[model samples]
Target: MTAVQRPVPLSVLDLVPVSSGSTSAEALRNTVDLAAAAERAGYARYWLAEHHLNPGVAGSAPNIVIGAVAAATSTIRVGSAATLVGNVRALQIAEAFGTLTGLYGPRFDLGLGRSGAPAPGAPAPPALEPRDDEVVDGLLVPSPFAFRIAPGSRFALQGELLGRVPGDVERFDDELALIRDLFAGTYERDGQVVDGTPAAGADVELWIHGSTGGASARAAGALGLPYGANYHTSPGTVLDSVRAYREAFRPGVLDAPHVIVSADVVAADSAAAASELALGYDRWVHSIRSGVGAIPYPTPAWAREHPVDPAVAEAVADRVATRFVGDAGHVADRLAVLQRVTGADELLVTTITHDHAARVRSYELLAAEWGARAARPAAVEVA
Candidate 1:
């Protein structure tokens, strides 16, 4: 009920990061605790993000975590920021979420990330040349950073390690279609009727996650599915992503475009305190971008002592710049700007710090500030 106090509702996206010197068991416990705290703090929904082979992140299985989170909270909707198309079968996704709905009722958002094949009839986005940050309506839309993993790198070998071969990978579009059909209980393959079991009748909302004006955005638009643009992950391309989706939009599942945008944030009792907590973020980001999986979040002190390679740091520089870090009120104001610039229907927050308590406190403080925003701005400034 209190979620309505803000100009726009705020939701949470958790990576369930295991901090330096923390165990995965403890991290999982924190995930459950944070979900409960978020519900109590009046955030709209809770989303768990998936990561593979991350030493610092414990949420490799977001669906399983979603189940645990859903069971612990009473009113908040729980689901994935994404359950990877490359990782799970469409049938598996349907059955798993279908089963979740059977147990927890219909309060779920089955958000999916772009993987596998592009949607049919959707052409690739014309590549936007990467450039410096461009200010639009006061929001900093940085240049898109191209993510690469050197061939033969451990990260590049993940598919092989996962027992996946190129020829065996399922098309993203095919899985999406099959999932919809399965949910409708009308799926058939080779003249044989396909059943989604409990999933067939589940009322879970489907969503598409995108970072650019690419096929994913087009597909979401064409299908009229809810689209979540990643300002937090791809600040440079988020505008392009949202614009593309809206441009391609056709009435299908939703009568109009429904969009959510995400941001990286860190809040503390004071702006100085928040800046300190967020100081180590670049090192954590570098770990992932460097073809090594996420290392446990580095303490600010450790980060200062052991600086990342200059090139590595430079690559993730935009993320460091884009993070909304400050005191509760300060962070809240920035989030409002983000929502406004992106014209987001809702805002998704993902915060990380070396300590679990600090991370939890960040969400709590932001929630309090957001709820107290009686003088929020109206109307969007196109980003």
Candidate 2:
């Protein structure tokens, strides 16, 4: 097949999920292996996501995982999908990535994000009810999901253990500013004027990640940094979030708007095979949305035997509906639409499954297809 030049580069986002019956040590080893595979597959970057107090997730510390991943992969850029600023201090963020840069020679991105909703107890503003699966220009634009923290969630415990007061979501702008000040050698830690040193002189990219068209978008725009919108996790409002970032953008770190949109995808030799591998996705999503953090990734048989409650089903419906699952051709078509619609400079592909081999194959198949797909249609403006 003749290869077509893709408009956008593709990257991987690793959550380092612990599969059912797998040990954390095994998960960590699997992550390093995956990063190596991604590098060989021609992926532009490999990022680690931070998740705390989750029995199913082993990447509670992305910076450390990044170091391991960087050591294993030769050329792929490695960094945080985002390190939640709420639980970590600016001094820690600076020194961690700075040290990584010193060791790895400037191939890092310090992606920052907020774990909690920026506005606490804020009511959704009245707006037109969007239809489900509204396809704009070929891209599927899902109806907005109204997210709320589970009342019985154990997240507060995670907060307490991390030395943060429970439910204390801080200002995203303040956190952004603090990171900037640290790198500029202006912020003081422990009453001493701290020099940016390694961090200040490091050649690392600063990125802001967000799920909605709110605080994170504005901060990234105002700071002139690159922004990543979470379409894979927050499908319903991804377009709005990207639009928010573009609209709020100002020339500082970057002269023009630069965006990367993410998607959940699974690819196989056939659509049915892909669907079979993706069978347990809903259950996996239910765990996170229910505030239990992620559970060990379940097997297809286990998911088939134990179904989620109707309420749980409803809570994760949008995410389930939006996931791109099919053969390589089909999945690539969907991602191409996503990239064209969002005007993304790059696309971040996240794939998860119980079998490690299956997960790795998904990326390899998608990369092959993405490289051979036809030119994307013209960009469509969202009315």
Candidate 3:
């Protein structure tokens, strides 16, 4: 069979999930192995997300995981799907990403997001002063409902439930500016210039990730950086966020706007098989939404046997409804539509399942179908 020609490039966003009966060590190894498979399958990039205090997630430190994956895979771009910028100092991020780029060459990206993860018993970092002037002109005010399911809500709830005071989420824009300047070797403190050394001269792509069409989108547009909308996390605002990014875009590093949309998916040889693989998704989502950290990924049998409260079900309905689950062809068709609707330059897929082999197979099947579809011949010739 001919490979499907995709309308847009495809990439992977892995959480490095620790399965119901698996150890973190095993999860980490699985991540490296998956990266290698994804590279060989022709995926464009392999990114890991940052999640803290979550028993089910082992990607707490994305930079470190990125290094491991980059070393294991020869060509696929590797980096954080997003590093919570508000959690650490800008200089640290610069140095870390710089080192990765220096070692791996240009195959590294730095995708920054707004929230921070505070460790238990640690005081929250002080908030940077609000900059009214930082607001971009013509930016649309997002809907109130947008906040309800936005990624920030999850980050805030995670901190609250863990009894940890998180850093100022509002400081993201300022931090972004600092990081850019640091990377460019233009940062200055008082009368002295601050340098990021190896990182300051490293070549790395910068990206801004957001779930809402507010600050994050605007910031990316204003800076002319690539914007990634989190359709997987905030389905309701994905389009809005992408639109916002394009609207605020200015010609800078990129001559035009570029957007990457993320989606949660599960694919298999048969629809029934795919559905089985996605069975435990709702329970896992419920754990995160419930303000209790994510639990170990449950098996399909465990998810089916464990009763779910109607309220819990309702709360995670959006996420469950948004996830794409089907056989290869079905999922490939859906993703094509997603690419068209968002006009995304690329699509990032995040698939989680109990069995490591099944998870890898899902990506393999989807990649093949997507490639085939993209390369299909037109039915009729133009006159």
Candidate 4:
């Protein structure tokens, strides 16, 4: 198999363990330890995902955790796997990340997602206003419409319309615009480059993460930000979404479009051992597909014995199970295939395992297999 010529930077999605037996402190410590190891292991980035009110996952506040992890490690890039921008105000996101950018320079990345961090006792996040039910009923709900509206009484709405902008839509746009301005303003206003940039105002690297095409891609393209597609759970749509993004891409914020696709990965010394590590993750993926509660990682035997429902099982199984589990050769081959299929400049890997040591080892084995390429060289010569 051809080697994945692009840099294979080992990275982590720190969900900080939230199992029944683990404590918050322990979770935090795990993040610290993981960050330190990732830095030492030559990983390029150590990111925390935003989730809320779920006992099975512990990354409720990505910013807070990012700060802690940043403090604990000297070199590895620290940032959010994503911040739930659809839930919080954009300025707040800017401020939090701006602070990190100030402290860490170009090493900080802000990945934005539309999903919200649900409150502990809250229900699932409010669907993006127009859901399938509303769509099927031909509901005209509201807008900031995608296209310009005419003054005529009739409308040709293909998708469900939500409603008119009752409040400040600029605030919404400003959320993003402001962040950019603030980043630039910090340097310009202060007359000093705090981060690495020689000019004023912060230019924190920005990325928009999405599971679909359309608004997210358009926004990222227009803003000149990098794009991260969520292929870890939505594997089927990866190619289509990426194609749409590249096709629709127009340079506004970025000189050229950059796309990263996330994937579920498992690796071990042998394919069987890697398969063993993947069983619990398979079950977890099964639960997500079935809309069941997020459960703790299960033993490989337990997962194999408890067959998931047949309806969503195939899709879940196909994406979640690793073809690369056996050993180094197997993982390298699978990754090469993934790189070819997605043209992913980078891969954000997510792994869920019951044993903490095994989880660390999984990436360690893969990094070892990727051999010297995975190892971080001397620091880049920053200006």
Instruction: Say which candidate scores most in TM-score.
Output: 1
> Candidate 1 vs candidate 3: which has greater lDDT?
1
Q: By lDDT, who's the top model here? A: 1
lDDT of 4: 0.61
TM-score for each prediction?
Answer: 0.91, 0.89, 0.86, 0.74
Give the per-residue lDDT digits (tens) of candidate 1, residues 1-383: 12332468899999999899889999999999999999999999999998877899999889999999999998999999887786778899999999999999899999987542222223333455878779998899888887654655545555555554353323778889988999999998799877669889899999999887888898899999999999988899999999999999999999999999999999999999999899789988888777688889989899879877888779898899899999998898888788878889999999999988899999999998888774554434353
Error of 3 at 288 (Å): 0.4
Better-scoring candidate (TM-score), 2 or 4: 2
- Model 2: per-residue lDDT, tens digit, 169-228? 545577677778877777787999767777776777999999878878988998899999
After superposition, which runs of candidate 4 have C-alpha atoms over 4 Å from their true positions?
Answer: 1-7, 104-106, 116-174, 186-200, 289-292, 304-315, 321-324, 373-383
TM-score of 3: 0.86
Q: Rate the local accuracy (lDDT) of all candidates.
A: 0.85, 0.84, 0.82, 0.61
**Candidates' RMSD to native:** 4.5, 4.4, 6.9, 10.7
Query: Per-residue lDDT for 57 in model 4?
Result: 64
Q: Over 4 Å off in model 2, which ranges? A: 1-6, 117-133, 165-170, 186-193, 374-383
In Å, residue 314's CA in model 4 sits off its true spot by 4.2
Question: By summed lDDT, which 10 consecutive residues of candidate 4 come out lowest?
Answer: 153-162
Lowest summed lDDT across 10 adjacent residues in model 2 is found at 117-126
lDDT for 107 in candidate 2 is 92
